[model samples]
Target: MKTQSRWIGFIAIGMLVLMTVAPAFGAGRPETTATEQVTLRYSWWGGESRHNAFLDVLDMFMEEHPHIRVEAEYGGFSGYRDRLSAQMAANNQPDVFMSGHLPPWDILPWDARKDLSQFDLDLSYYDDTLMATFYAPDGFLIGVPQAGGVGGSYLINATLLDELGLELPSMFWTWDDFAELAQSVYDASGGTVYGALDEAGGVPYANAGPPHFDISYHNTTITNENGLALTADQLRFTYEWWGRLRESGAVSPADITAQADDGANSPIVNRDVAMLPIAMGSFSRFQDNTPDTLVLFPAPAGPNEPFTFGPGMSYQISAHTAHPQEAALLIAFLTNRRETGIRMGTEVGVPASGMYRDLLIEQGLSEAEEAMFELQNWIIANRDVRGDITVHARYNEFRDLVRAEQQAMAFGRQTIDQTVDAVVRHARNLGMNVR
Candidate 1:
C-alpha cells in the first residue's frame, strides 16, 4: 500500500514537472498548426535564370519556414503587365508581385496594394534615398526595390571592339565622344556592323535614353508639379541627333533596330550592333546570351550630370492578400537574406541591401558581374545630383506614343518637328499637361 501510494505521488510530481516545461518547449516551436499554415502566391517576370534563382530561393524559404508555403507564378516579361492587370481587375492578384522598373502607381489608385511599412520587414540595410523612390504620395511604402544599381548604362560588345581595333570610350565620355566612337565602330567594321542600336524609340524613361538626357540638358526632370517639364525644342534636339546617327549609319537602320527585343533577337546579342543601352542590372542576362565578352559603360555625359537612380525592379504585396504577414516574410527573405543575394548574384542587378551587396562581393563574382557591381557602387557614390519625375498614371501610354512617333520619324514618315508636335498634342490629349 505504501509502495502504491509512493508510485502515485511520483507520477503526479512528474506530471506537474511536464506541465511546467511543456509551455516552454511549445514556445520554441511555431505557434501555427495545419489549420493556421499560410500559403502565399508570389509572381515575378524574368527569363529562365531569374525564374530558376527565385524558385531555389523560394524552396529555401519554405524549408526554413515549414509553416509557410510559397506558390511561385513566374514567366517571361512578355504580357506579364497585361496579365497582372487582368488579375488585379478580378481581385485575384498574387500575394506578392513584381513591379517592373517603376512603382505600380496606376494600380495604387485602385487601392490594389498594401502599404508595406506596416509589415515587420527589416529595411534598415537599404539606402534611404533609394527607398524614398518607392513611396506613394500619401507616404505609404508601396513597393520595395529588389535590385540596386545605375539603371541607365550602355552595354558594349568588347570583343567586337577589340576585333575591330577600336578602344573603349572613357568612363566620362561625352555625347560627342559617343557619336564619334559609334562612327568609328561602323567605319572600322567596314560597314558589316553598326556602332550602336537606334535607342531613339526605346523606352524613354530609361535614364540612359533621351528623356533623362533632356533632364540633364535642362537641369530638371521631364515632369514637374504642374506637368511636362520638357519643351518641344529640347525634344527636337534629341531626335535630330539620332536622325544624324541613323543617316550616318552610326546606329542600326530602322529595320535592324526594329529587330532588337533585348532577348536572343537583340542586335547586340546577334552581333549586329556594337553597343546598346541597357539597365545595368541586365548585364548578366545579356552576357549569357552571347559568347562574346561584354562590358558596361556609363551613358555618355550630357550638359549636366544625369539622374541615375532606379531600382531595376521592385516587389510589392497585394492589399487583397489574405496573409500579409506571410507575404512580408517572403519579401524579407528574398531581398534581405544573404543566402538569396549570393544565389541571385547580379541576376536582378546588384543587391539593394548593403549587407547583401557586401556579402556577394565577399563570395566572389564573375568578371561581368564584378563590372556591374563596381558600376553600381560608383553610381551610389556619385548619386548626390539626384532628381525625380512625376510619373503619370498613363505613363505607359505616353511612352508607347513616343516610341511609335520615333519609329515613324525613323522610317521617314514624319519630320522631327512634326514628331515633337504630335507628341505634345497627344501627351495633352492623354492628360499629361504637356507644357
Candidate 2:
C-alpha cells in the first residue's frame, strides 16, 4: 500500500510540473523573455523649452512602460556637436540622440548611427521626400526626421517695419527686392536700424549663384547628398553681392553681423534691423527672444529655383545600443504618436507625420507656428528639386575653409575673386570634385 501511495504521489507531482511548463513550450520553442528592467540614455541639444518638453514626453513614456527608464542629456547647441562626436568615437554615446538637420563632418565617417529599419517601426507615416533626408550613403535609415519645413526663410520683425512705416515685401519677392527693401528701411530709419542681416551663410547658396543657374552650394545628386557644387564664377557672384550689401549699409556691417550671430545680439532680436532671413526652424526661438511680434515670409527667390532643404532636424539611434527595440519604440513615440506631437507642438520643427500635422491643426497653433506650417506647405509645392543636403565626410573641411575666406571678404580682407579662387582650390585639395 505504501509503495502504491508513492507511485500515485509521483504521478500527481509530474502532472503538476507538466501543467506549469506546457504553456511555455506550446509554440514548439521557449520564448525569449525581456529583461525585468532596462534603462536607456537619450541626448539632444536645444533651448530650455525643447529640453523640458522632451523630458515630459520621456516621463510619460516611462510611466506607460513600467519596466523601462530613460535618462536624458540635453543642452544648448554650443560645443554639443563636438561632445557628441567625441562620445561616438569612444563608443559611449547615448542610446539615441539628436542628429543635426545635416550630419556634421566629424561624425560622417564613423558609421556610428544604427540602421533603424532593422527594427520593427511603422515608417509608413512619413512621406518619401522627408524620409530621404535622413538616409546614409549606404542607403540605411540612419536617422528619423523630427520636423519638416522650408528651412530657409526670412523672419521679419513686421511690427518694427509697421512702426517705421515700411511696407512689407510680398511672399514672392526676389533677392534684388530683398536688397532694395533693406536699403529702404536703412535710409528711412536714418541709420537707426539696418535693413537686413546678410543671410548668405544661413541659406546654402544665398550669396553664391542663383539655383536657376543649375548650381548649388552642395551636391544635389539626389535629395540628400552634400558636396561642393559651385564654380568659381558662381562663388564670385555671391561674394560680390554681399560685399555690395555691406558697402551700401543696407545690411549690418561685418562686426555687427559677427555679433548678431549670437542670437541675443541679432539685429532683429535687438530691434536693430527690420528683417532677418532665417530658416523656418528658427522662427519660434527667434520670436521668443524679441519683444516685437515677428512674421514669417517666404525666402526671397533665387534666379533659378525657390528651394531650401526640408525637415529641419533629425534623431538617430546609436549602433551600439543594446536595446534597439526599446530605442525604436521611443523614437516612434516621440515622432509619430499623436499625443506627443500635440504636446511638442512645433517645438523642434513641424512634425514630419502628416497625421501629426493634421492633429496640430485641429488642436490649433500659435500664430508663429501656423506661419511655419504655411511656409512648409508652400515649400513642398514650389521648392527646387532637393539635392543631397546631408553633409559629406569632408563637409567640415569645406565649410571651415570657405567660411574663413568668406569672412575675409566680409571683413574687407579679401576680394571676391580671390575668395572664390581660394575656396575652389581648397575644395579640390580636399578631394572634392569641385571643377
Location of the lowest summed lDDT over 10 successive residues in candidate 1: 101-110
Global lDDT scores for all candidate models: 0.76, 0.70
lDDT tens digits by residue: candidate 2, 1-435: 999999999999999999999856532222223555777789988888889889999998999887779999998887787888898777777888887545232335426878877777777878787787666667777677787764556788888788888888888887788889899888888888888876442323232222222223322311113346666665666667767877887887766665565366667888777877665777887887878888888767755555565564677888778777778879988887877987787778788878888898898888888888888777777666252554445665566666667667677787777877887787778777664
Clashing pairs in 1: none
RMSD of 1: 10.9
Reference-based lDDT, residue 321, model 1: 78
Instruction: Compute the lDDT of residue 106 as modeled in candidate 1.
Output: 36
**Per-residue lDDT of 306 in model 2:** 55
- Give one digit per residue, the lDDT tens place, for model 1 in 1-435: 999999999999999999999855531233234457887889988888889999999999999988888889999876788898888887778889987435222323425788888988888998887877677667788677887765557889999999999999888787788889999999998899999988775533332236545655676544544545678887787788888999998998878765577666678988899998877777887888999999998777777866664663678888777777778888888888888888877677777788888887787877987998788777666644231345566666666777778778887889989988987886788777776
Can you give the TM-score per candidate against the true fold?
Answer: 0.84, 0.82
Which structure among the candidates has the greatest lDDT?
A: 1
